[model samples]
Target: MSSLAKQLTGVVANTRKLLDLCGSLQAENDMLKLEVQSLKVAVDTSIDKNKQLEEKVKALTVARSLDEVEVGEAGINEKILDTKQKINDFVREIDKCIELLK
Candidate 1:
């Protein structure tokens, strides 16, 4: 019957449209998942960098305190050497970070 055929064609068209939408939801979901992963990585990196900076600040504070306290000239020389060592260590860390960026 003509009516029956028209109804079947309409049903088919509607079904195809629904399937296309469901695929949404699928591609959008995939993209969302990738974005979430990227954001997580960024957050983790930020947290790690913050912790490292906090530790460096603590070390610098201790070093500064040492400068304020004296134990004579010998102690002063030792403090200077220790401070130089700390500076060298910081330079090494900076170089490593630069290498990673490259």
Candidate 2:
């Protein structure tokens, strides 16, 4: 019965070690989850800032196009059409960026 007792003690010690390791892993997992949450928030903030910047760019493009429109008819029409295409391309790019983030 002495040998049996030693074997049981060993088993108990190993069980304790396993439990400790599991607890530490769980803690690390929780820390990683929090970090992921923070990173997601950061990404969201960056996306919002990018959207604001895009809006500013679009407005500036329009304003500049209008200023150039006073230069007269023939070439101004072409410039306006080019500006519209650029705006469309920018919109599509923003959509792609949003999809990538998601």
Best by lDDT: 2
- The lDDT for every candidate, in the order shown, is 0.88, 0.90
Runs off by more than 4 Å, candidate 2: 71-102
Could you give candidate 1's per-residue lDDT for residues 20-68 as a string of tens digits? 9999899999999999999999999999999899878968776786767
Local error of candidate 2 at residue 84 (angstroms): 11
Candidate 1 lowest-lDDT run of ten: 61-70
Q: What tens digits encode model 2's per-residue C-alpha lDDT throughout 45-84?
A: 9999998997898889777876776566878888888888
RMSD over all Cα atoms, model 2? 4.3
At residue 61, give the lDDT of candidate 1. Answer: 75
TM per prediction = 0.66, 0.69
